[model samples]
Target: MKECPQQNLIVDYVFRELDTKTKTEFEAHLKSCQSCQQQLREFKAAAPVFQKARRIHHPKRPAQNYYKTLKENFYPSMSLAQRIHEWAADFFLTPSIAMRVAQAVAMLVVGVFLGRFLFFQEPIPVAVKNETSPILAANVSDQFLRHYLQETEMILLDVANTNPAEDRQILSSVKQLAIYRQLMQKTILCREHAEELNDDVLANLINEIELILLDLCNTEDENLIETLQNVRRQIKDSHILLEINSVESRGI
Candidate 1:
């Protein structure tokens, strides 16, 4: 069977990340996919308004409890099967092309998650016209932002926990590039919202996360393995995930 390049391109389109030729091609097919058209409409409707939300978190928002939990189970346990799979995987795939392979494998592996909605469906549900209630709009925007952050936390946990390869190891055929790209867009939305509202802590952590995510999207391989390892360490070292966890844990 032939493949649908539009699948990946659609996510890019919703985020306004596509090139002219690709965007033109996607629109040509998009005219036929009623489902996609509906999704795109919702995406456009929810965006700019959410970006304008002045207050993303309330004054008496929930406090952090996960910081203690994080300190206790800093390196949470992983299942034996997952451990074996990752370990054996390291042997078969080499360093140079790990990302390329991972990109291919990720497309298939993450389909269950992305296919169901993440990649193809419209994620933002808020309407632009209802921006009259600033608090409500901010809450809605924060909900989506939390969802994106949690997903990224899980992916980073896997990348961090997976057994390290000496030179070239981890993150190949392991997950899809489209997934990170989607997360990147979400993070951007979250970061912009965070910055505009003077939420410095959230903005800073998101900035750190964006750095790693961009690397994942670009697959920069100069010090590839080391870079990934550093990303893992940074997650813990910078305590960015912990901070995001704190915000999310308190349901902020």
Candidate 2:
């Protein structure tokens, strides 16, 4: 007897709707066809949840007019059956937008509960002004030194995975990193010496420079090497500015 066409057998084989003889023949064909094997995997993954959703019973079908009203109001572009299928699929696939919205609301509620339980509150503001003394500046400089060391250690720890050529590029950028670290220290020292001088502006600038250094340290793309060089030049300019200011103040 002539064998049945593969396309004719696909849907029946997928749903296990075939008789013993047909199923045996289909299995024989499936073993040799990679495409059919992948299709079977997708169908197997989707089938159980679809079967469970089909088992759920409602009292009765809604009125045609009610469905018409809903379709007109919310889903003018989709048919009623498509909308129902979408809702059922989303219910089974937990990462759907509806599930995300519910998760967000639940998190917000938990955050409020924790705030009440822990008695947590906002931070107090610190005042700053110019004419700060050197002693306070030195303390601020120490804090910056500690931060720079921590960041440098993190970068060095990951150095083994870096390409030799890339490492050389990153090494050239080290002078920029050094300058940034020095500026951070000086900014801290200035803040300590002049309690009335706010450090927020300088701190933000230093943070931007730190982010560039971090990118250079972490990235492996050859295309990004040029961009890192450009950022190094910018950092050098900032360091020069700091040096010029320090010199002028000292009458150098």
Candidate 3:
């Protein structure tokens, strides 16, 4: 029979399924013929996917004697030179244990520095003027009064932006805004009282209330009228907190 054509042999040769003689002949033909060489390249590219598919569909099973043969072939003896080489490699190439110790020491130093900076620093004392001092009292009252005026302006601006058609929502937002304004005014009055008594605690409380008013004025959400009302209630509650603190501070 005549020899099989080279083009058919290309696929078999690409997949390594050709006999030795046929493979030899196919490679020789591939060297001489550019078309056969190109065909071989194309077949080589397409053969891997088919090989993978065959492996997936028909996986090979291990022989029963594989582990027994493996154990029998295992070498237990080592030459002196080989042993020395292994020891030398482990000593030179393995990572140093001291590196871990150094890292831990570094972290401890950083932690101690941060703790000292955060907790042990002394708070500077605030200077307090005499009770019933007119100048200092006037300054504290003016500070909180400015805060109250700013809060009132913000509330008025918010109300101006509300739609009159949505009367319920507008009224709710306006009522909450009014309550916050009243709280802000009360905070200003409290500042005057604090300045008259020369009480640091009351001054701090007034300052905190002004901050709360600023926060409420800055809050923006047409849908959060209820949440805003809660904030207003919180500001009202601050007054009660101030009263309780004032009574406690007087030793009564």
RMSD of 1: 40.4
Return the number of clashes found in candidate 3. Answer: 0
Q: Give per-residue CA lDDT, model 2, range 1-252, as digits (tens).
A: 233347457778877799999899888998887677766777778878798898776644667778889888997887789999888787657577878888789999999999887996643311111223223443554345345434433343333234445566554454434443444444444444334345354444445545545555343455455655554565455553353243334431
Q: What TM-score number comes out for model 2?
A: 0.22
What is candidate 1's lDDT per residue for 86-157, written digit by digit as tens?
776864564348766777787787777777775675534223312332333344376677777789888787
Per-model RMSD to reference: 40.4, 18.2, 15.1
Ranked by lDDT from best down, the candidates are 1, 3, 2
Question: In order, what lDDT does every prediction score?
Answer: 0.69, 0.55, 0.59
Off by over 4 Å in 2: 1-198, 237-252
Off by over 4 Å in 3: 5-138, 142-147, 155-226, 229-252
Judged by lDDT against the true structure, how good is candidate 2?
0.55
What is the TM-score (0 to 1) of candidate 1?
0.40
User: What are the models' TM-scores?
Assistant: 0.40, 0.22, 0.25
Task: Estimate the TM-score for candidate 3.
Answer: 0.25
